[model samples]
Target: MTIPKDKMLEMLHFLMLSRRFEEALTDLCRIEGKIPGMMILCTGQEAVGVGMVAALRPEDVIITNHRSHAHLLTKGADPKVLMAEIYGKRTGCNKGKSGTLHLALPEIGAPCTSTVVGAGPPIAVGRAFAQQYRNEPGITVCFVGDGATGEGSFHEALNLASLWRLPVIFVCENNRYAGAQRQEEHTRIENIADRAAGYRMPGVVVDGNDAMSVYTTALDARARAAAGEGPTLIECKTYRWRGHGESDPQLYQPKEEIAAWRALCPVARMRDAVRARGLISAEDLKAMEARVETLVQEAIRFAEESPYPEPHEALEDVYA
Candidate 1:
C-alpha cells in the first residue's frame, strides 16, 4: 500500500491546513472574541480526517460528529465559508443559521453535522439505505468519537447496516476520551473495533496518527463496501491535543499525556517522512507552510469582512 508521493504531499498539505484553520479559530475566540460559538479543535486528529476523506470520491457522503472542522475541510468545503459560519456571517455555508457544530455543506457531499453524541451513525445508515434503494454506487461515511460506541443508537445502527449490507463505513476516531472521562473508566471493551464482531462485519484498528496507514485502510474498506461485503468499522486510535471544546478546563487530561501526544504530532511526522523520502525538499516544506499561513489569514479576513444575516431573513428559511 505505497501511496504516491504527490498524494502524500496533498495529505500533508490538508493536515497542515486543518491544524492552522483550527488554530486561527481558537485565536479568534480567545483573543479577538470574534467567533460566537463553541469550537472543538482537531489539532492532533487531522490525519484521520485527511486520510479517510481523501480516499473517497466526490459523490461519497460523510456524516460527522461535533468535532467536525477537519472532516468538513477535508471534504472540500470552503474554508472561508466555514470561518464565516463560525463568525455567524450571512455568507456562511448555511447562511449563518448553524454555527460550528451544525455545519451543512450539501454541495460538497457533507450534507450536515450533528452536535449530539452518537447521533450521526443512524443518519448515515439512513443515507446509505437510500443509496442502496436508488441503486446508487456512492458510499456513506459516519465519523464518530470512541464514546459513541457506548450509545444504543450506535449499536442499533450497526445492526441495521449489517442486516441490510449497507454501504456505510463506521469510522471511530478513538481519541481515548469521551468528553471529560477517559475511555477506560467508561467502557468495558479494550478496543472499540472488537464490538464489530457482534454485528458480523469486519473491524480493524489502525494507527490514526499515520495518515498513509489510515488512507490504505480506507481504500480496503471502500473496496469491501463496493463489493457488497457489508459495512466495516474502523477504529482510528488517535488523540486530541486540545480540550473537548474551547472553554473546557481540561482538568481530567494530565499534562504529561498532553505533552507525550504533542511529541507524536501527526503534521510534523508526515513532513519528516516526506522529507526523508526525498519526495519534498526543506524549501518545499517551508513554502507549503507559508501558503497555509496565507490561506488561514485569508479565511480570517473573509469571515471578518462578511456581513451577518439580516434579522428578517431568519423567517425565510424556516419551514414551521
Candidate 2:
C-alpha cells in the first residue's frame, strides 16, 4: 500500500529518531558508563516499532518486551524525560522507579513494558478485554520477540484472545533468534505465523525491515481488530545488529549473518525510499539528521543535569 507522502516522510522521521535515540543510549551505556543494568538496544528493529505505532491510534494500548527504548519514542515519549528516566532521574516518566526495561507512558496509552520471556501477551489480552467490556475506543497491541512464542503462556494467551474475539494484535519481532539461539535450533516451523492457525486467528509474516510494508500490514491488522474480528498475529521477520543485551558477547550468531542484515538496514532502506520518491530534498534529509542528533544530545544533557530521586521517595509509586 502506498502511504501518503506526508505520512511516509513522518515514518522516515520517526525511524531516524528511534535509531539516533538508541545509538545515543548505547554510547551512554558503553562509552560513558552512565546507565546501569542490562540495557537492550533495538538498533535494527526500528521499522517494526515505527510501522506498528504508525498504524495505531494514540489511544491504543501498547505492551512491549525488553528491547523497548525506541518503542517508547514511537508512542510520543519525550526524549528528554525518557533519557532522564534511563538515568534514574527525578524527572523520569516513572520518576526514576522503572528504568530502561520497564518504562511506561500510560497517559499515551503504553501502559507497561514486560521483560519476562512470554509475559506480555496475557496482559495485552487482559487490556483488550477491559477495553471491550468498558466499550472503550482502542485496541491492545502485544509486542513480543520470536522467543516469546516458545513459551506456554504465549500460546494460552492467543487461545483465549481468539476464543473471546478480543481486539488485540500480537506482533512477533522474529529477529531470527530467541536471545542468540537461532530460529532453526528451537522452533521447527518455517514461519511463526503458521502457528496462528492453531489458535484460529489470521497470522501474517511481513518484511520487518521494510517500514512501508510493515505499516501496511499492521494497518490491516488494526482494522481487523477494530472491526471486532479477533486478534491477529503479525510476525516481523527482521534481525538485530547487536547482541540480545549489553552483556552478551553474541558469539553464537554468525558475523556474516549480522553483516547481511546490516546491509538490509531498515533505517537506510527508509531513507533511500524517501530520497527516491523525492518527498524531501537531500538537504532536507541532512537537516533532519542534524535535528535528530541535536535532540538526542539535548536528551543526554538533560538527563545528566537532572537529579536522581530523593532517597525517601523510593516507595512513592510502588504498590508494595
Q: How many clashes (backbone N, Cα, C below 3 Å) per candidate?
A: 0, 0
Top candidate, metric lDDT: 1
Candidate 1 lDDT over 190-262, as tens digits, reads 8999999999999999999989899999999998887777799999999988899979989999999999998
* Model 2 lDDT tens row, 186-247: 89998999989999999999999998999999889999998999999999999988899877
Q: How accurate is candidate 2 locally (lDDT)?
A: 0.90
> Residue 107 of candidate 1: its Cα lDDT?
97
**TM-score between model 2 and native:** 0.97
Worst lDDT 10-window in candidate 1 = 31-40
Return the TM-score for each candidate structure.
0.98, 0.97
Residue pairs of candidate 2 with colliding backbone atoms: none
Candidate 1 off by > 4 Å: none
Which 10 consecutive residues of model 2 have the lowest summed lDDT?
24-33
Clashing pairs for model 1 are none
The segments of candidate 2 whose C-alpha lies over 4 angstroms from its true place after superposition are none
